[model samples]
Target: MNRYTFSTQSGKAYYCNSIPGFIADQSTDIVGRLVRHAFDINKEQANAWENQITELQRRLEECGMEGDIIFEYDIVRLGKRIDVILLIRHMVFSLEFKNGKDIFTTQDAQQAEDYAIDIKNFHKESEDLYVCPILIATDAARYPNPQSCDCYPDKQVHLQRENIETLIPKITKISSLYGDDGEIDFDKWFNSPYYPTPTIIAAAVEAYSSHSLSQIAQSEAGQENINLCEAKIYEIIEYAKIQKKKCICFITGVPGAGKTLVGLDVVAKSLDDANGLSVYLSGNGPLVEVLREALKKSVESNDREREDLWKRAKKSAGKTFDVPKPEKLFNKHTQAAINTLIQSSYAFKKDNASHSNPTPENILIFDEAQRVWNQEKMARKHDDPIMAVSEPKLLFSIMDRHQDWAVMICLVGLGQDIYDGEVGINEWFRCGIEEFKEWELFYSPLIFSQVEDKNIDQEKILSCERCHQIDELHLKTSIRSFRADKQCQFIDALLDNDPKQASEVYQQIASKYPIYITRDYSLAKKWVRAHVRGSQRSGVLACSSAQRLKPEGIYVPTEIDVKNWFLAPSDDLRSSNMLEVVASEFKVQGLEIDWAIVCWDADLRRSKNGADWDHYSFRGTKWNKRNKPEQKRYLVNSYRVLLTRARQGMVLFVPKGVDPEEDPTRDTEYYDGIYKYLVSCGIQEL
Candidate 1:
């Protein structure tokens, strides 16, 4: 049959379980593998490449070409060959094929001429014939590295396939670039694997938005909030509009930047508009409980309206919409279960990636991105469970694909965080970690591709002492935060091991907002109870660590029972999984008080020999997931839930060591940097 057989001469192998019929059979040496190393890649890429081949055929036909479009084809038999064949206006015939490796030589020319003879003999065409051959090498650089698929001294065309796209534009630019290559062979292409003419292809894509983000056309939030705290909500809106990108702006902020408020604003905007889908994608346990209650209120507010729905639906289909009974939809237990399932071992990765139709008008906003949406690398074995082992650089690649279906992508979390080193910097900035790495397109699954920008300033972005303010145009002028925010700011700046950055946090607070050093929990409680009294939602999360809280405790709350509380995990992976049980218990009582009194419990003495236990152990070779042994590490992930909860504001319920009475402010300048910044901004003095 002389079927065109192709195989990787040498490369690494991969395994895929995407196809049921192609499932790997058990019992071989190195049994489970997929794509085995690309080239014939997958159904997706093969068609993508073939489409380019047909485009070239279309070009030939437009200039008056003809003949059999494709040879008798069978993928399993013929492999990746005979991309297309065309008969030109003047007794001229052509054959087109794409090679990952550039093959633009006499040998390649002979192969095409031979294909020409075969076509002629089989079809019994006219005797007068001229054969034209075109060899397309997609990645021109890799194929002939540094040598192009164009300007071949002896032969024709090397339409650049850098994007696997650009094939069309290149198709249009061909006649001019290659002088006398003739016309677009539309007839041949219409009959090739990449069916439908270029016009049809363009129309179809016009249906799907382009996947690109340009700085001049990107979201402005990063530039606006370059100076202050707060969600920089307005900027987010602008960015979404300009790029037309459905995205999740991953945000990592302290207690007061108003990430949630911004999220709410986004949700409200989504609901009111018809073009975008704006959803608060966080279905966390506690949060879902709150959402259910709110949903119930909505149902209560619209009981009569729903009855009308029942009447209308009954009239039409002889049935009711059933509306799922708002109560069932808003059941705390049910919502909690849904939240748990969404973040379960099964749903996290793929669900996050998939933004479904009947998709929201804009984006599905997700906060606490780091905690829940981990970029995990699943080390799956056929015998192993389906979950990925979760490496740090996991989803670093497909973040764009995840954002494409939406209008904007928002991620909020600390960057230098997850210090335990299970991930990579998903955000790229050439200068350092803090700045945003501007990207236009992420072409491959390898994640990022930097288009050469003549103006990427590696120079540091100028900023004031707060390290938050900058030259961004959209500065927020709202003081929606509070007093202890000063203390929190102090801890973040001056309490560092190396005494520097800021000298007086008091001054820092003054420049931004008023700083009140209060040592009364009752008074703090009074303020919280007064403000968040009924729907009064606020907390004074404690830092039992004496590590993060000690400084604030000195001037904040003096009498705290720092012993039997949570010390809070510095970085925890199992938070969402365990907190549900704990939250359900205390949340029922005042233990789940409207205001939380948090502190890093001084009791986590790192496991010596445990008590309430049985889990797994990966001791070198064998699997021992049965009991707590000396080699693993685990902590109550609830520490995050504690710090994150205040729907309003929080207090400094910290330990003494984490802060100080005499002031690391050292008589005056300890937080000088912060105070100076606040002073310049005209914030009241601490």
Candidate 2:
């Protein structure tokens, strides 16, 4: 007769006196209910698995198994009843079911062995025939000894628990003597919902998730490929990971506030987890290329080899495959591209709903979100009634579809740079966009002045009415440009002064930073050309609307060469998904210029409004006074764009006596010109 024995660290032999540690973990239900995931399991799954063993026994007998079955029936002599007991050839065959993974351990394996021996001995004196013990576990993924050590080699079998209906096959197989005929038909068992079906466990690895199961992966030389979360980026990572109450965090920053840095850091934090991904997007095409090149360093550095080395990688899995491993190829750009394509590709049929399957790698970030919000106004479809990308409604629709996925969409922009109409038409993104919004102001934080009471509010004067609804956070700190406390004060004071004082301080600031005022278009063009070359630092050529700065030579377009930008208000411009095609006129703003020339000629100066229209124009298209006012408004916007763009120095030109040293206005139009506009906009004249 077969015999079984069970003992612990104490080494005392265990009898059928009491159940072992196995029974302690079981409450009223199996232990798997305790397992949790990043996402929640539906409630319908709960009641379906609730257990009562009698139902299983009845199910087996109904399926034509000629035997009496008992449910949770404890044998008095045996101490504990088996989950399933059958009578065959007058010998008892006991079956124990392990549905929970917790029961699968080395100790549990030993316990199962002991039970088999105990049951065999229990029926050792059976007057009839052979006796055996059957051990069956359902969906026990963690079952130890899939080969050699335990009797079963496959931890997960193709049979999941369902209505008591599944008991028939389970009983028929376990009850029969062990042999080839006893083998399970996995194809048939897989379709049976009466028990847990076979499935590979979701894997956890120390490496990055770049490869797919369809592809094989080779290990890399160094662990550096995966980025470690550190510093300020860690907070953003925590915010994305653990906020139970959902919040759409819209982080607004100026040109260099490190929005991309923070965004990337968030991406780094999520790299190891299955619930996170990183994506970096921007409106600037050249900048995007630069950024892309920069990121390749990290990816390649982590890989520790050149391109040829990666191609030669052999699968460590020992199986040949065609596809790349997700761990090997899953870089920041790859994730970004996947998510962007997923959102951009959809047919919005009326009344239709969509579902998204999100993995940790699903993330969509808009670096130049302001640009994305607008339909391409200049590139509108000829048949479509609405203006192209600049149209707010269409952009809202795009963002809405993505919102349905509960995607963490991050939008970054500066108040001056964004067209407000194109944002937040969807409910999910509505909160905190305007009033609760952050960072409306962009300036040197400690920059205070005694000469001028306050800095000019661009909207109050320049009439930049777009994005009025957006809640803005002003970044008070200046990291890009540095100025001493005294110089900063001096610069602010000089800007508000009369032309003489303004010129004096402008010269002073220029002396330190070097702003050369040149009326010569050739000089300006030459200086700008030199700056455009990618160097250790950059340079810009700023041209105001009053001055028409023309390149010294005839312009020619070539894919291979640097193209010079000519500042002209009428320069045709277009917006594209792959490009930011603005003319030299508008492009010069918000960018650092090396040298700027104020080009004052007929075409640019003609639109210079009768200073009277300046007040009404600053109030938005509130007037029906005609395009005359509009032209003047556009002209002011042109100037604002020009003055703000230059980093080192800029030149100014005014019609004859319209003071290059002070406010430019005819004596009679003086109040209507610079005075009224300045006072309305809160600019204190020094």
Candidate 3:
């Protein structure tokens, strides 16, 4: 994909010869080039490009600057583009324009700053350089002093349009303090690979809008693995379609390895195909609600913009445009369309099981397939003894109703089954081997490396002629925490009670990814606030069973609106930025925050000998020990989910309990051991 619409070096000479003398063209000719690069150019976009180009050209001529000027630079990670970027003398200036506006808004400022942060965090060429984010409200009445504005710790400065010329000289004087990196090479910077780690919500919105994987995903970190997996799935799908056979595929990966992203990409591609139809089903209620709401809002905003642009285009052409009284020009943004593409797995099962007809969709993609309910849990949930079938078997029966061909793609995350009766991959294997012997199976090789359970018959499944192992189905890299790719390994070793291994891994990643331990709750919150920059998100997280933490201002029993908590603005009281409310593992399993404050409680603490962990449940007034194996495992996995939810870094808040005699539930011994244990594991103290 083309990175920018137009690029030219400052002064009279240009460096790039590919466009052939376009630098000497007029403003109208430059606007034509920008329009060519745009996928769908409307009147508003074209007019804005013209104005920005004309004004920038005048300013460059006045200042006599010597550097590169780029227009409409694409930031693929956010699915947005910068208005203008000026690279001059070891300084990168990101300019955001608000044409015909009289006032500057907080949202506009955040947008400008976010673009600069995206460059510093993801752009390999700008890692060590100084970045300045300037917001221009062309028609504003008052302009602040250029010297009065301060630079953020991340080296971003927010300024108005009037300060652009004056601020350039001031930044040049201070550029020496940032180290002399000399001039930036335009060719190397332009060709640098952009590896952006987008949030799951952002990825889903981009994918559902019909964007390809290359436009939405990272380029270097495991891009080949994801592509190979996608290709292998398509091959299986084609073979099944041509041979008129039913096939099942299993894709396993480490935590935050883009399993959901791969599934969403395939579903989008299937929708674009003329002959095939696919639906993405998930049992994660929070994930589904957040994604659907985000998509609806995006569609509404685009429709409104398009309508406004259409009216402007007609008026500019000197033609009379009639405004419809009762109807809208675009009505494609409907709830029914969104629901058809993404649906609840439970609702799908109930609807299909109530009827005897076959489904129209031939391809079914299941997210979090390991969390599907077993036979007993399904029966208990419905309060019906006759419902003896597991969810996997029921889904298989529904798909088997198709006469010609069908394909089932299961996205599994190992050791992520935190709830009871949420059968892991074993149930699907058993169903395929015993009940549905005719279905062909394709699986990742990682499935065999998991801890052996009595229910899984590895030998029997491997001996079956239909089962095939493919290495491409496994994603080995964790792209969620782009700062540290080995974060999952560190978390795994820490939770497994291997202090030596955890310490070793922590030493390797400490400089890039910070992990701190603190005894005061306020310190943890302060750390998160200090580390977060621009529009990056930060929130407080705690385990669901952390009842003893109520006195410390953390109440896990109160439910939060996942949509608002994850997507709301900073000033909103219900937003995560407030940090007054906390989300448990259940609310944030499939989501992530930029920075996190994990509130550690006595629900899971280190043993007296500091060799193992102890699990407990607070009932009524006192704490009781958890004895069941599944219950213990659930408590352990809850911390796993909480620890891995932050993309940047996190701080563990281990509060110091009061005297045991005054408060039996809040004993000093309960939390002290865990704090010391974490410190020994190489976590720095706050």
Candidate 4:
């Protein structure tokens, strides 16, 4: 089968003499070919493809262009396809045609630009090539002076169908600007490797709706690592099932390393198992809420399509069928089912703590397991002393109820514990070693490498007979920031007070992944707004302890509806795009935005001598130092979450403090040292 619906640059189609013949080919043949590649081709889609082909052929022939015209180019990450890709010389044109439309809309323009950006960022061969995104509204009035050649820094030009015939000459003149005059290799470009790092929300929705992550997981290296992790966990699950033994597996990775993706994939694949069920649990409330909401919307959409098909089938039978009252697919029962599949760890604990019976699910995947509460925190939250055990211990006891077989997979993130009483990975191992000795234990070798603090008893855990180290369980690279894999490393160095190393790493990724600093909050907002485009999300983020930022129009105390904040339309006031509401590290820990404005406050500021960070908390009107080790770690981790939340880029907004005499709490010394330190780390000032 062909990779695309049709191609004009392969085999006999490559010759310029055969171009006219190919253009004049029947639309039915092309439609039929596209139908074979698609799952369900509607009449509207078929007509659009036919019209796109006819319009494209006329434009190509009029321009006398001799290059490849790929119809229906697949963009696997988005689960959508570009209408056409015109590869002429060193230029790559991404075309999105709006059939029968007389006016261009913002949605269509953004869609066109998104395709170009995706190709430029993810497609290996198109990285350096000039990509022009054109939105052609077939019936729209032609622009008197179309800016077809006005290219952005990323080499993307948005244009209309008007004056498209003149595009070839303009493209030819700019080909020299790309530093390559040679013709593009059509085959190589068409078959180029595409590494798309989808947002976690996108991955979860795809996994739940399609029950397959093939389209979402596209990177060769990153996807292979995730797949291996999934496979190894499944192997352990199967062994436990066959041997009638309980087992637990720990999978660790750096921040944004697709650890959550592995857990979601395991749950998705396990749906096929009729013998048992799998559940994905997370302590992060916002992450669970967003995923469930996205998946619920997907379910409702699919149901609506099915209902439409049902109505059409009844009409075809020539029988007048009374339309039944619309039954909502995303009703209470459906929500209950969704909750069972992807649940909050706290809720899961509460539901099972009251019962001694075994759960129907034999496999449980814990996401962000490092954030599980320690015994002290758990005790204070629960009224009953019997339920006061640490989260891991309680979770293990629940799973241990299954006498025959059960499996538990913990997805651990390093340096992500941003809240009090959230014990790191040590709690899980401690529980496994001291309490659940009968259950077999498997962990990533990378866990030991990252344990800098001697809190975990590695020797005792490894010496156990049931404990085994598996190399495949650890993910090495960061998939979230496809533009910069070393972003986490840079953040580490910056926080570790190693400005030289941080500056060196920043230099390497400065061009592709922008990191800027600004003293003015408005300027930081403006910078993020300018960089965001095409449905990309940008938001203001502050640490929860940043109480002083309330004076700067950033109120961390404001409770944001995360589902709306992350998923609402840009025009909606509730949307993060509005930048009215600020999300704290607590709300956005496991989530991400395309661009971010990180508001810095006196809560975690550089020390007087700039030797280390000093942690502080706001009490009444004055700031008090937090000397506790746990308190200090949480303060640092809060910034870590905020710093790493941006997938594309971020702007650190360090407010200029007021005069000490006017307000001692807002002293300039509190912020100046940190701002200077950030500059020394190679963060460009806005």
Candidate 5:
């Protein structure tokens, strides 16, 4: 059977006589499997399909068209199949059929547009073509003319029609205005390259379930490292299972090196084993929230009606489908559930008593393990109910309660600990050596050197009874910024006060991943807005301590809801795509955007010596310098997080300090020094 049930080349008649054959052929194609599955889950869809075919057959008989037609055409990598695709001269039409409907719903229109957008973004051959998505509600009144809107002009068109009487006329008019310069190669368009972009959540889910990383998109440069990381992780899991030993391994990587991906992948693939289940935990609240939501959305989108349908089908099979109670469905083995396998560290710690071990799950994967709280932070908070020495110590104590064997995987990112409570990587080593010596330890030899943790005594760690350093555990490349592999190196050098080296590294990657620096906030914003294309994400980010930035219309704290800001559509002002709101390091540390505007404030500035950092906090009408060493480190790391959050490029908006005399809090000296230091690093000024 053909991949598509029906397909014809451009400049050919799509005859109504072939509809029956197409339907018969589709019964054996991919769409057949989808339809059978839909019948078991959503019977309405199965009924709709029959009527849809009849309507399309009737419509084609009425509308005389000169184009290629494809029925049940699978879109690129989205796991979605478009109803029909009409390839005409210089234009492609995406048609959605609501066969039994009398009214065109908003959701129908959005789905049609989303299909067109997916095709345009993922289909390499369709990028230059004018793709118009039409929604046909067969029973609805016919709209004789297509509406004109400037929203996605030239690239997108929307049509709501009752029949195909006016469809040909509209297509002719659209072709006359925006048709391609020449005829397209039908064979090439049919086999165009598809670019798949699975979110970190989806990638993890697929990798875990499939026992392979083939589905996750990777750049040619980082594919080897990504594969190596996945292989090493799998080996560790198998070793723990075979050895029947309690082990803890640290997987360290540069910023955006897929550290979280490695953790999630391990958890996903490990959950199905009879030996033990795995749970993924993250100390980063925003990371956890966004990832959990994304995972929930992924599960919901794929099997929205699976549960109800399964219940109905099971009744006929003489099986019981227990109706869920009022409580939340967070049970093990319920793969369709939400946040069952993935959880937040704070929530997990809070729910489980310090001395209690809830599950026998042999493995616990910790993403951003370095962000775990220190002994001081946990103890200092008086009003908080839960008491723990440190997150690592607490984690070890709970896992120690395991009956036989267990493993804890810590996914670490270098220089990404951006909060005060964060104790860095040393806390885990200290906890393991000083307290949980019975648990076996395995980590990359580069962990100590990468974090530069002055608090760690390497000799004591090396002398630990069960400590083992594995070279395969360290990930060196930055997969996040595919445009420049060495972008993290430049950021590290700049943050480490090596301006000369930073400048040299910047020049090498400047052409590919542009980094713009400007004192004018508006110019920096404009630069970011102009650079981002298609649905490429762009946003403004600042350090959490950027209280003085409110004057520039960027209030980082209460103004932005990180979840909505990150996930909302471009039309929603709350979305990051609007560039109206700014996310702080706390909200955007692990995630990335296509382009970003790093709003530099007086929160962290270059010291007089021009080598070290001086941290400041805005208090009322004055700027107070924070003299604590730990605070200084966090303040510096905050900038590192913000700077590295951009996948493609970034622009720095350093305000010139509106007449420093009028507002002493906005001193020009504080802003100028950092701007000059960044300029010295070979970052271009707009």
Candidate 6:
């Protein structure tokens, strides 16, 4: 009668009727209990389970297979349940049942594969075993041609199809291919350590509502820094409240060290303040859109799912409480809810009034603060009064309008300014000295003299009596590459053209995280398909200025519907899993994917001497290089963003350019040098 139920049996002992007993007990009470506890359980699911159980029982009884059988295995943290997991010898068979279905859909295969992958990646006992995900569509016409298992990497899953009639032969083939080594200990497998990775969508919703971060973020190395950052920010907020003075903190981190997580935590913790409230603001349009839609879906759908359960629990218990209305809290009209908790800086500027404070949120958290525009870009883009001033100066002025104390936290990232107008960290220094001298400034000690690339006035910032530097303000770990901490180091060495160091670091981490390169996009796609298993995400990525990639059949998604592009089913053409429509670096900056194909074009390439940044505008029929410093930097940084987007591994596809006699624009000379450089940097060429 418990929710999220599962049955397990030891290997070598066989089933002994444990699984059969559970399936055959089809009383009204038991069925009702299962229907209530399990999600999306209907006649279709019941029929599928009944058929799958009967077939599995028959196969086991006839074959006399050893090992264990687990029914309805629960991947509790990921919110997934497998139909049946067969632990035989050292292999884990992840089965998904489709009843009365004639064909095995791609989505169905992906769903089965995801369950297998989740166990292989996160289940300790199954990590060393061969995980095979099989989809059994009971009424399918024909069985898939069984392929040898030599092509797959260790623990890498492959999708196999079967029908109810072919189940015995399929099992025999798999068991023979992967010969039985030893009996599987089902008790140990059931209790194996499961490290759950909450998607960014789930993390955002949980953090914004409950301020509980540790449960969602399973990164052991980065959790300390997250906690430290949060504690320091809270300390600053308390000080600002007591002293009745304005304070600003600049929190910096390497690419994916949970800066956004800290920012959302602040927004959640500050929501209920009767007087001085706070809102999370960002300049990243795609991030905002994705987060809003994800939060909306979480609230609306989850609330309805739990409503009936809440009523039933209340009836059994002696106490009654009002059900939480997530829709009301996160609706569009509610300014303080999730939709308005984050807003675009440009939109905030457009809505700014000359003399009034906007919406009474005294505390402001700005994500990606380094990407804020300087005065010139703002003036050219906007006609408002604040357009002539830098964004930081304008924001400081707006916050200073409050008569009481206020706090502003700038969630900054180092070396992520991939746009022309971004002034990096210097804009904040200028604003602090010339515009808002009275407000206190706080930063990490590593920011001052360490920033060599930017022209920051260190003297002006250091001269302020209220300047304070705190070490806890900076996050030192990269949470995105939780398996390989040296991922960012390897990227830096590669981008800096230090091939020796890059190769050394790659050798250290290559076994854990694989990076491949190819001259053909087809090879890259094929490699991605082979390596990716389970519910792992894969996509094609390109630079925003990759106009030449159109000839290679790679088109950048111009108008990205962030939700569908990130969360759609694999079979959908719009989904990133399709590998047809590629997303640009601009749309995928703060996100991570499991596997990716980075299509390298001539926008940014390597010359014989060093890295080359050619900013080209495709006007008429030719590529004209824009001779501007900012434009060149943007082009270079765009590649940097694309290069580091993949969390697990990536394949760089440097095109083999057309002959000079055919298309002069895409000459062979333009691409060969870059491809060679990438190869030299220890990227395995496929």
Those runs of model 2 whose alpha carbons end farther than 4 Å from true positions after fitting are 1-240, 250-275, 283-290, 293-364, 368-473, 482-508, 524-534, 537-686
Candidates sorted by TM-score, best first: 3, 4, 6, 5, 2, 1
Q: How many residue pairs clash in each candidate?
A: 88, 47, 0, 0, 2, 5
Tell me how far the alpha carbon of residue 669 in candidate 3 is from the true structure, in angstroms, after superposition. Answer: 1.5
Candidates' C-alpha lDDT? 0.32, 0.32, 0.78, 0.80, 0.71, 0.73
List model 6 lDDT by residue over 1-686, tens digit each.
43223433212121222344444454343445445556655454554455556566666767767665665677644455676777766788888877667898776877887777777766778767888888888899776565445525655546778888876677677767784788666556676656545556657777665655555565656777878888899999999998898999999887777788788777776766776788888888888888887677766655665554455444544354444422434355543466667777778767764556655788999998888888888888888765588888888888888777889999887667877777677888778767787788899987764332367777777787788889999988877775566788888788777888998999988887788888988889998887766567789999877888888898886777767787776778878888887889888887777888999887776654656434665667777886886677667667777877777788889889989899977888888877888788798877
Residue 401's C-alpha lDDT in candidate 4?
Answer: 97
User: On a 0 to 1 TM-score scale, where does candidate 4 land against the true structure?
Assistant: 0.90
Evaluated against the true structure, the overall lDDT of model 2 is: 0.32
Worst 10 residues of 4 by lDDT: 9-18
Give per-residue CA lDDT, model 2, range 179-214, as digits (tens): 222322222211211100000110111112332211
lDDT of 3 at 446: 75
**Top lDDT prediction, candidate number:** 4
| Model 1 segments more than 4 A misplaced | 1-254, 283-285, 297-362, 370-405, 415-480, 483-487, 497-503, 506-596, 603-686
RMSDs, each prediction?
29.6, 28.4, 4.0, 4.2, 6.8, 6.6
Please state the error at residue 488 of candidate 6 in Å: 2.6
Per-residue accuracy of model 1 over 450-553 as CA lDDT, tens digit each: 11112323233222121122122122221123222443344334222212433465455543222232334455545444332111223345322223222344
Query: Which lDDT tens digits does candidate 4 get at residues 596-654?
Result: 99999999989988889999999998999999987898888889989999989998999
Q: Provide TM-scores for the models.
A: 0.34, 0.36, 0.91, 0.90, 0.75, 0.78
User: Candidate 3: RMSD over Cα atoms?
Assistant: 4.0
Q: State how far residue 154 of model 5 sits from its true place (Å).
A: 15
What would the per-residue lDDT of candidate 3 be over residues 1-686, giving only the tens digit for each residue? 53332244221111222212223458787788677667767666688777766666665655566666767677877778788777766778787877766676877877888888888888888877788777777777555544434555546554434333443454454454443558787777766667788888878778777645556666357678788888899999999999998999998888888888888888888877766788899998888888887777677767776676676666665545554422442356567777877888978887888786888789999998988899988987765343467989989889989889999999987677788888777788888888987799999767778522336678888898899998999888888888888888999998999878889999998877788998888888888987766678899999999998888988985578989888888889888888977999999988899999999899898888889999999999889999998899889888999999998899999989999998988888988988888877888898
